[model samples]
Target: VGAGGETAHLAYNSGASTQHSPLEDENDYEESDAGSAIGQLVNGTNVLAIHGLNAGATSSDFHIEPQLIITTRTGGGGQTGYFATATPGAPNGRPETLRLPQTVTFSRSPGPFTGSFQLSITGAAAGQQIRYVMASPGGPFNADVPAPTLTSTLYTGPVTVNSSRLIRAAVFNPSNGQGGEPSTAQYLLLETGSGNNTSSFTSPLPIAVIDQHGGGGYGPGEPYKTSFLHFFNRGPGDIARLNAIPDVFTRISHKVRGSSSAHFPKRAYGMKTRNDQGENKKFELGGLAKANNWVWYNPWKYDDAYVRNAFMFQLSRDMGHWASRNQPAEMFLNVNGGKLDSNDYWGIYVLTEKIESGKDRLDIESIGSSDIAGDNLTGGYILKIDRADEDETAWQTPTAQAGSEDRIVVVEPEQEDEKPEQIAYIKNYIAGFETAVLADRAGNWATRNYQKYIDVPSWIDVHMLNSFALNPDSFRLSSYFHKDRNQKLKAGPIWDFDRGLNADVDSGAQYDPRQWNGTHFDMSWWKQVWRDPEFIQGWVDRWWELRGGALSDANLNQIITTMGD
Candidate 1:
C-alpha cells in the first residue's frame, strides 16, 4: 500500500547491465519470441521481501526472479550503484520469500527524515503482474492503500522519508490474486543515524547493548546470568522506537568466546537465547533466521584488517564445506546501564552463526541417557582440540597419554552427567585409530589406517584451508571435529581463522610462502597419514583442486578486496 506509483519502464536485456536499475534484466530467462525474457525488480530504498509466482495454472508454476539495487546519494551529482541478486532457494522445504542481505543500508538525506524509496518491475506478461506494498513508519501494511507507483524521484538536494516504512513487492499471475490471498510482506525501516558522528551510539553499525544489571563482564568460568540485550538496527534513517522493551529481551546465556584471545582488550562473546518458558528457542539477529545462539567475533588484533576471519569462513563454505555464516557489524557495549549515555564503541565485529547441533545447522542425533548402543549412542558428538578450562573435562590422545603433547576436549554434550559415556566412546575410538596409525608394523598400519575412522576428504580440505593461509594453530588449537553417531568422524565446521592470513603475527621471513606450517604439533596424526601413499596422493590432489577453485589467487583477491571495502 502506497501513496503513488511510477512505472520504471525496464528493458529486458540479454545480459548484465552496467547501470543499477529495476529495469536491469534478471538471470531467470523465459524462452520467448526474442530468445529469452529476463525479469527483474529493483527497490528504490530498502527492499523488504520478494515473492515470484508462476504464470502457469498449477501452483507449482510459482518462481520469481528477484534482484536488489542500492543507490548511494553521492553529493549532488547523483546516486552510485550497489546491487545484490538473489540465488535460488534450497531444493527441499524452500523459503517463500527471498531474504536480502542485511548490511545493505540506504543513505540519509540532510532533512527531517531518511531517503525516499521506490519499487519497479520488468518482464511482465499479460497474466503476470507485480504488487508492491508499503507500511507506514513503524507500522504494519495498510491494506486500504493502493499499490504505489515506483517513479524515479529526484529531489532538489536529497530525498528522504519522514517516517520508517516497511515495503514488500510480490509478483503473481492475475488468477492467483483473488480473495486477497495473504502475500509475504517485507519490513523496511528508515534509519536516521546515517550522517551522525561515528561513535558508540551514532555509528552506522548495528548496536547490541547488554545491561547485565550490575553483573560483572562476561568472562571464562562465568555462569549464565540474567541480562537484557537491546539490539538497535542502524541504517541511514533514524531508528524507529517501535517495540516494547520488556517484550524484547529474551533470556540468554552469555560468556566470553575465545580461549587464547579471552585476555585481549576487546573480547568476543558467545550467546544462547532462550524462550519465554526458559527452554531452548530460536531467534534472529541481523537477518539471520532461527538462530538461538550466536558468536560476536572481535577483530581488534587485526588492526582494522578484520576480514581475515570472515573471509576464511567464506572460503570454507565456498569450497563446499559448512562454516559459520558471518555478517560484519560495528559493535557497542553498555553494561548495567552504566554512566555511558549510550553503548561504548567496541569496534568492527562479526556477528556469526554459532557452530552447534540443530536443524538449521549440523543436523545430528542428540545423546540420550538410556541408549548405550546402536546409532543413538554411537553418534552426535562435537569434539575439539583446544585449551582446557578448569572444571571442563579434557581427554589426552594416545600419544599424549604416551608422553606426547596432544589433547582433545569435548565441546558439546558438555553436561557432567550426560557426556562421560559418550566422550569415552569417541575418545576410545580415536585412540584405536591412532594406534593403527602409529603402529611400527606395516601390516598393522594397513589394517588400521586413519581413513577407516574419519572422512578423509574433509580432513584434507581442512589441511588445505589452514595451509593456504599458513594457519599455525590449525588442527592443534581451536580445532573442531564432530561425529554424528552413524557418520564418520568429520574434520570441521572449521572455527577460529582470525589468527591466519598473517594477521596475528609479524609479516616476516617466518611466513614463507614456499614453505608451509604443516609440521605443527597437531599434525602428528596427519604426519602419520602422510606415510600412506594413498593419503598423500589424495591430499595433493585435493590441495591443487581447491587452489584452482575456491582458494585461487584471483578468487582470494576478490574476496579480500570486497572485505577491505
Candidate 2:
C-alpha cells in the first residue's frame, strides 16, 4: 500500500493445515488490520509491496497470485457480488442463475369488438404459472406495477370477456420467486350503445378515447387524476385510415386546462404521459416528435370552422417560425366509470404541443441555477404577455403603467423552478429594450438604438401576420417572445388565434383586414417602435415580400383548401 502495510505469516509445515497431497499443501489467511491497511488505498495510484520467504521451493520457483472480492447491495433489494474473474486458486462465481420469465401473449389483440370472444393467455415454462388481473370498464390498470398476489387470479383455462374491460397478465415462476413484466390490453365492446354513440359516429381524423377513473370530473387546480388514453388510427404506414386496433395506449394524468376556455362544455385538457409509478413518460403521438406535455384544445363557439388556431400555427411555420405543431383528433371522454357510448363523444379537438425549452420546440439554450455571469446569464428565456393567474410566476415590467395588462409571465423554466435572478435578468432586458425604443422615437439613436436589442425581421413578420388577419388579441395576449444565448430578442411563434381570421362575427372591426389590429390594445413596445421611420419602412418592405409569396392569393387559397379537407 502507499502509506501503510499489512503482515501475514505462513507456517512451514503446520499440522493444523488441512491438506492431502504435496500440491494441496495450502493455508488460508485473513487480514485483521482494518484501520491502516484498508484506508491506505488511494484514488489515483497506490504501491503494494510484498515481503515473504519461500520455505519449500527455490527462488526461481516462487510464485503468487492474489484475488480480491467486493460485494454491494442496491436500493431495490438486489445485490452484486464480486467484480473479479475466477482463478485457479480462488473462485468468484454467481450464487444463482438470474433469468426472466417468458412474456405472456394473448390470443387476440387489444381493440374494439362487436361481441364476446374467447381469450387465451399462453406463455409459461415448466416451473412457471400464469397470473392475470381484470379491471372493470373505465377502471384503472397500470402495467408498470406488478400484479398483486392477493387480488390476481391464476390462469387455469380460457377466459371469456363480454363487456368492455382492461386485462393485465404476467408469467410468474414460483420456483425462482420472480415475475416477468406484465402485458396489458384494453377491449371495448362497440355493440353496447351505453349512451355513448360509438356505433354511428365516424370521423376522418384519429380517435382518442380517454377513460378517467373514479368518475368525478376534472378540476382546474393541482393534483391531476389518473387516466388512460387510447388512440386509434390506421397502423403506421396508413395513418389516415381508421382501425379497430389502437396505435397508442398508455397511462396519463389529466386535468382541465386554460383560462376562460376551461368553462366551455367541450373541455380542453393539459395532459402528460406517465409510467406505472406515475413518473413523466415521453412518447411521440400522431407523427409528432416525442414529448411529455400535450394539450387537447377544444375549438368552442367563437371559431365555428374549428381550424383558426391550427391554420394560424401552420402559416407561422410556413413563414419559417416554429409554432406549436398540432394534429386533428376526435375525442371521446368517459367519466362515469361505465361502458362508453354516444354520450362520451366530445367532438373534434386539436392535439397541440406545449411550448417550452426543447430542441423540437423553442430550441433555446438551457440556463442552470449557477449560471449567473457572462453569456450563460444573458438569454435562453421565454416570456409572454398574458392574463394573470394566481398559480403562475410573473413580474411587472418597469415600462408598464400602473394597472396595465402587461404582466410578463415566465413560460420556460416553469413557475416553481424559475429563480429570482432569472426573473430580474429578463425584466431588466425588457426594460432596456423599451428604453431603446422610446429613445429611438425621441431621435436619440446615437447611444441606444431599438434595432440593437431586437430581431427586426421577426417583429415585422409577427406584425404582418397579425395585421393581415385583423387579430384583435394581437399584441395584448398570448404574445410570446424568446431569446437564445448570445442572440437578440425575437417575437412570436404565434398562439391563440381561435378568435382571429374574422371568426367572431359580433366584433365587426376584426373582419376588416385594413384595420390596424395591434392598436386595439395598449400596443406597449410596438407603439414606440412604430414612430421610427426606419421601422415603418422595414415593416412595409416585409409586407410586400410576404404578399409576393406566403400571403399571395394562390398560396393562401391552397392553405385554406388543405386545412378544410
Clashes within 3 Å, all models in order: 22, 7
User: Can you tell me which runs of candidate 1 are displaced by over 4 Å?
Assistant: 1-200, 234-248, 339-343, 401-406, 417-419, 440-448, 504-522, 561-565
Give each prediction's root-mean-square deviation over alpha carbons.
22.0, 10.2
Best by TM-score: 2
C-alpha lDDT values of all predictions: 0.57, 0.71
Best model number under lDDT: 2
**How would you encode candidate 1's per-residue C-alpha lDDT over 1-565 as one tens digit per residue?**
1211223442232222222223345563432231121223343333344322223344343334533433435588532222212345733222222221221122321111223444333333454444445444212222122332222121112223333333333333344331112122222222335443222234444556544433446776675554445555544473422221211345466778677677788988877776433457677776665787888888876535777778888899889987877766655453432232323456677888988887777677766666567668787888777777665677777466222454677766765645556767887888877776677235634564556788888888887788777776777787888888788888887888776776646555346766453464246566666667677689888878878888788998888887765
What would you estimate as the lDDT of candidate 2?
0.71
What residue pairs clash in candidate 2, if any at all? 195-342, 195-343, 196-341, 196-342, 196-343, 197-341, 197-342
Tens-digit lDDT track of model 2 for 413-445: 576767778777877888888877777667644
